[model samples]
Target chain A: MSSSANEAAARASAVSEMGRTIPTDAEVPHPEGVRWGMVVDLDRCTGCQACVVACQAENNIALNEEQRVLERRAKTWIRIERYWEGEFPNAKARFIPVLCQHCGNAPCETVCPVWATYHNNEGLNVQVYNRCIGTRFCANGCPYSVRYFNFWNPEWPEPMNNQLNPDVTVRTKGIIEKCTFCVQRINRVQVTAKTEGREIRSGEVQPACAQSCPTSALVFCDINDPESAPAQLAEAEAGRSYTLLEHFGTDPGIIYLKKVDPHAEIHEDEHAHAGAHA
Target chain B: MQEPVVADTKTSNRELLDFVFAWPAWFFAVGGALNGLLVAAFVVVILMLMFGLQFLGYSHPVYWGFLIVNFVFWIGVSHAGIMVSAILRLTQAEWRRPVTRAAEVLTIFSLLTAVQFPLIHSGRPWRTMYWTFPYDWNRGAWPNPRSPLVWDPSAIFTYLTSTILFVYVALLPDLALARDRAPNPVSRAIYGVLAMGFRGTTRQWRIQTVAGLLLSAIILPIFVSVHSIVSWDFAVTSVPGWHNTIFAPYFVIGAVHSGVSAVVTVMIVMRYAFGLKRFITRDHIDSLARLLIVVATVWLFFFLLDFFFGLYGTEPAEVDTWQRRLVEPPWVVIAITFIICAYIIPVPMWMFRAIRRNFFWMFVTTILVNVGMWLERYMVVVPALERKSGLTFTYGDYAPSLSEFILVAASFALVILGFLTFSKLLPIMPAADIKEGQILADRIRVGRANVPAAMRE
Candidate 1:
């Protein structure tokens, strides 16, 4: 067999292996084209929260005041979740960015009575702000706890209000708002590509979180397109890639590359401790 | 069993119609107070509309709290009507005669109060039409049938409509009695219209009886399904503490437990308030207490099953949620209080005949049962949301705000106010039902004693 053919076969086997591990029910099927997804490299994430700030600014998110944070009602579309690996002397602070997975069979989509949240053709979980009646059922349905409720009318004081993004809707209080993978950017890129009579290039559409990540820990791409660099990278590093809460069978669009820990024993022990705590 | 001493038709009419004819001082006082609280609730709702759900104790993760608990609690209370009127009627339980109207009336008022919670609890209560109304014509989008929130309204509205019909059907003869006995031409005409031109005839009585029976049979499944659907609001969710298979039966049985206990509480109040010494006797209360013992036991069984099954899975999230409920400070206190009030105190005391027959003890204990049931719902709802997922960093505690407390208090006041208004307009206890029981009363001689007996159809 030719070397190119052998490499092609290896890629196909790796993709199949990833698919086999991620169990999906009949309700969720991989869409035929332009499936937008993300690959987060935990090894590279510095827990700086730059993506969180970028997401807030781009999405027109409500100002999460100190009081709101103290009350545990702060709305951050993307958050850096910090975990400690070991006790006291040997402790290692680990960071993982948590956001909406935009699942193929999204639990949030199914639970919204008014069809306020739904999966678009582009594999995007779209939330219609006007349609929501604030039942919060979708929030409870989500296993990831990424969905955030707007408890109060958004306030940006005087000058900060001027910085609000015109591209994104400022969600009113009482409705749910969550990570939409910066859909406004996607729409802009798609419309621009369509106007020029060309296909959207790989890596052309970048979410605010991915765009602002200084270390390039977050990579956004069209997962269905085999030619996409990030898609190929995910397949190339297939052994390390895993979805959040894979047991849920949500068929999440976001993939995470496991944090490379040199001390495997400490990581294993921490896993056991987390299991007991859970 | 000792046969109840049935009152004569004239005496029954005068006694049952007393509250309708005259204004009692306590009635005005209590009604005024409840009205004041309801007004406060209305103000809070208006503030919520203006300010957003910030008035609520809702936070990230713990999105639902007191209002949802009250919704479930009132829905549970509404089950009293079906359990007392329908189920007892189907079984032909003799003690159900005087208690049926009060229970059914409680159902209507409680349900009316219950439906309001889901509306007011929403972030955008004004836009609740999008959730409730059948279609969105502008968008050509219908409400998602897959959602339990959709099923909730369909189930609750059906239960409410059928319950109204059930009460109205049983109320016709009583309305006729009120029409004949009405002090003024205004009241007489009002009662006449409500009575729907019914005259005492053999055929009409037969049809009325059959209709009542048919409604009783038809409403039984709705009664069961209503609470089961409410249970699914939590159970169908992937939330660990709420996702148990036993939630349906647990909620249904718990509803019956709290519902019947509420019935007993209402019955005792009706007995003293209307001077209904003859109709709502100790024997009636005893029979209800006996029914409650079985219901409470079954509810406890279901509660244990839900708790046991929650831990049985041994999924970290599930175990963590249970731990929060069972071992955590405030939640542990609530769980203990719930067990004590819902089961420990009342069920054991109810096992004794003396305690069951005593109106004071029955009233206090039944009230305790409802308190415990409310807390039980709170424990089931809030703690689970506090520890919703394995991402422990996101876990949060919820404490209901002042607005939430006010709304919860007003719900009780609303049910009481509704019951009082209904009592003032019509007989709270059915005079027709009491007279019917009187006609059925018989005496049979056994050995040296003349035993009072019932002539069953």
Candidate 2:
């Protein structure tokens, strides 16, 4: 079908999603119960950093060199924070891939003076790069520490430049950047589905992190769609699933299934350990 | 008893105006040195903008560091002028005459210096105007009013305008005096324009006095609000050491504490610089010192109040932050310095009658107080930032780069350069106000106790 024909179908579906209210602007108002979310099964994650690499490659994020990491300036849209369970013979390593929570009551959203970052209709936290003046107030407001500021101009060597994704804009120096849940991929799928005259199916749009997860530990889906894989997993693991920093009332979009360790009693004294206990 | 403030009108005019008309060799040397440093700082800042803030040692978790500390420090320094001038003017303090102009000028210059930090701290300084200004463009955007950073530009701009007006209105009679006694027609013409047709008539004086009083009332609130808003820049953030209810009053009182101390320091500097010992007398310094003591005590109370609240608060983050500031390495030294310099050493030193009256002691204590205040701002900004939510594996650390040091040094030099330039162009001391104050003092001398008599309008 032609592009205009695709646009017409998309608008019709969008209007149908919004219960047949006349679409007011170019962008369609998101239907109710359309919160896009993730469910990370910690029991299955093997501490491998495949998701990190995949995210960097897909998003055109800057290389995280040793020096940058040492300076704490490494730009990782999604990263694995490892925690040691115990010492000596009983030592164990656990991994949690931390990313932007995209909270319903986001602290970062409210503090951005320029309105550079805000929650979109589809529960996506959107950041407008050009409008950001790099006050970094949002970074401070964020409990997850997922947001990263661009301290220096991003550069890519000649051959490396060829690997850059055309879909994603490589952000310049002196602005904040963070995980977008691969909004580009979401849009791509949306455009394709709209052109095909159908609703986005469950598990249709996967973020880089979810697609590259070797053990299927990370799952992304429309939580509002009860039949979606994430929704089914989240419901099945309801007893085990919990959000990060639930005390902050952030209402994070990501849910994590508790790591089932038989040796949980061994590390009870080490309260500093980043676990379900924390 | 009603002595003229300028002992000899001709000599005083020549002495004050000579600093402007004739540039002594030492004046050029000092000014040149300061300007040279400022030029280097300007270059460093520009390079940072072109390259990145990494050149200035900013990183994750500690995104706000040196520039923010300097911003708060300079803003605190500016608080003294309005506190001394506006409060004293409202209370009808007779001794406020010789000190008011210097205090008000310090406010103007320090504010000029302080306002630059927000721009410098901005990752994209070039785009700051777009964020700050209120013009409708294609973006259909305005700054989020909820953010204290947004409140900052409004408060700072209002304060700046009010201060400039306050200083100018108060300078009218002095400007007219300078015009009549100007060395040449060119100097006379310039002063004439500045004087704005003020012939020192009854109506002009009436308007000037009433206007100055009214401006003082207007400026006093902005003076209090500006620093409070600056404090809110931190308080509004969820950072543990910040996000306190006491920040507004705490910041206001701290500003006054440092500001009044700065006035004492400047008074001493002016006393020697222009040989104005007769006008800026021991009595004036003593009174200011007494005021300083009261300010210090109040500051000490707030300091403990902040600490007590931090300790009392159940939040683990707040407790951890207090520990970092009070118990951790390197931070303990800073905390100690802040206590000693801002309170411990100065409070007792300012209490002594001889110390307050003595120019050397007053200068030393005041400088020490300012040093402590600077450290206090550092303590407030860095310690809170150094340790955030604790979820991140690596704790952030910050040490200002060489460029940051150069920029800080240049900020001080710029303030001095501005003051020096101002001193030459205008009277640093308000001669007419002092004479009028003296005349008021001489009125109603009932018995040995010469009561401060009221002036007729």
Candidate 3:
């Protein structure tokens, strides 16, 4: 083999060995000190659910049929939750995207009997599908309700079956699954960077949801990397940026920028009037 | 202390051994029905394994359902054994003699039944060995010690093993009795092997008594720890209604309440079914009822404390969970039923001596306590998951499916069937223990009445 190829192979082996040696305790950081995170700017969100569709296709998620939704058993890794401000006449629609926050102190990580779910050094809350015994304890432990269990084996009919993502595993029934922040894509980027003997560049590791976002609301980054644009954005927008369920002490990787509401007081007054009139 | 008037040793031995040696018609009828339900449950479990957990009514947000509720209920029922046998044995309560073996048998069967629900409820029941077994089958990955699910099996199995030993150590003399009275050579050999050559010598009796006492002391902590660990399965979680500090004591007390009530139910059934009326008298029922009044009241106190702590926190998510349990339609009904049946009606009724001693009323009340306790566990498990967090959009309600119902029914059938099968093999009421009690029986004159008493060793 060529000298550079040999170097790449050695580096890859070393990285694998490092991964194997890393303590299972989530408090430990990655050797590379990389913590993947996201900053969602609520101001730019349109609640169009493009990211949700993109995530489903990229992650080999089961197609949610009408019956599944009606039964309230649908699996949507990234969901846009809509809320209404004020009454019907003066009603204003608001949307916030919810996904696995991949917390530094994830509640879901501790409850799995088989270590089916854990926080990797990269700060990703990883769910090992094959290892899961489906106690659903992790799902109950999660405050965000982001973890989803496969009630039934996923089915994709006809041509859709061919579209399954080769990069992701089609999770079997009885195990839990959730957004991995598209770890497959992250791995690809890492491998590509390692092969060429260089560090991964900022903006190169976009998850499917962030990649498909039309308004650039979702920005994936290594939050621990000061050079990352999303990290810088979160730092700059500190006044508006907040994590969902801040009181939970989960210390989530996802930082959300609050939606700028100019008519906040007016909406409150209208809501009060509507309540009184009713 | 009031002791029931003891019957002659020969009569007690013959009467207790009757069910063991002869197969009563009702045994066949009830055992057959229970086996049939168990078969149906086995088929459902097979279907679930073939298909998926979709057979159950589990939806998003509400992952646990009737299976977990039944698991907790049966675990609570298993507590009857140690509560009656070990505690009474240690305290030297004479009335505990006839009830001890039956309670221990119930514990073993119910625990055997209880451990299956988590396995059956899992998405991959076959793969659960990796989680339940202590060995690191998957490379270097041992079962997570941090998880309460790991603690559950450890506590439960320890309790199961110790309980079996407790029952066995106490059963040696009885086993020897069965051996001497074996109907056939084959039966004689089986009993002979189980009896371990106990010839009822003074040394053997002394050793047996000492072993039983040692085991009782050893199992006391296990008895408390088992339910506490089970409670930690919920307490360790962030779920609003479940994450209370009072869960350990609350769960332990509640388990004893349900468990003791189950013993009362079983003793009453044994009285009729096995013709054990002489051994299991109204006085035993009266004592158990008096015990129930205290257990049920203490359980109520813990229940109220759990409720008060939930409200006192004033956390919105916690408050919302409480509101859902109290104000919500179906949950409110369940809460009310749980309260009235578990404490309100039975506790007060138990206060009246006439009610406590009446077999029929005691039977009805004890069954009601178990029903209420079952609903109590249901209230704890389901409502918390329904209002899990302040994320109202993600909140969803759970209903157990037909499959879940079948499996739960099957669990009850499994325990009953096991107990019945055991009854045929061994004396349901310990013969040797009863003989010893009869030896110690005495009376003392008090005022115009002759009060029942026991001779001190």
For all predictions, the C-alpha RMSD in Å is 6.2, 4.8, 4.9
Interface RMSD of 3: 1.7
Better structure of 2 and 3 per DockQ: 3
Note the residue pairs that clash in candidate 3. Answer: none
Of candidate 1 chain B, the 10-residue stretch with the lowest lDDT total is: B1-10
Candidate 2: which stretches are off by over 4 Å?
A1-31, A265-278, B1-22, B443-457
**lDDT by residue for model 3 over B1-457, one digit each (tens)?**
5454567767877888998899778888988899899889989998889888888999989999899999999999999999999999999998899999999999999999999999989989988778888977744467888899999999999999999999999999999999999889999999999999999999999999999999999999999999999999999988899999999999999999999999999999989988888888888999999898888888999989999999999888999999998889989999999899998889989999999889999999999999999999999999999999877789899988899889999998898889889999987788998887876675678898976555566
Considering just the first chain, candidate 1 attains a TM-score of: 0.86
What TM-score does candidate 1 get on C-alpha atoms?
A: 0.94
Please tell me which predicted candidate would have the highest DockQ against the true structure: 3
Candidate 3 residue-wise lDDT at A205: 94
lDDT of each: 0.87, 0.83, 0.89
lDDT of 1 at B45: 95
| True-vs-predicted CA distance for residue B142, candidate 3, Å | 1.1
- Kindly list the per-residue Cα lDDT of model 2 for residues A116-177, writing each as its tens digit: 88777577888889788898888878878888999988888899999999999899898999
lDDT tens digits by residue: candidate 1, B293-362: 9999999988888888988888889999999998999999999999999999999999899999999999
The 10-residue segment of model 3 chain B with minimum total lDDT is B1-10
Better of 1 and 2 by lDDT: 1
Candidate 3 residue A156 C-alpha distance from true site, Å: 1.0
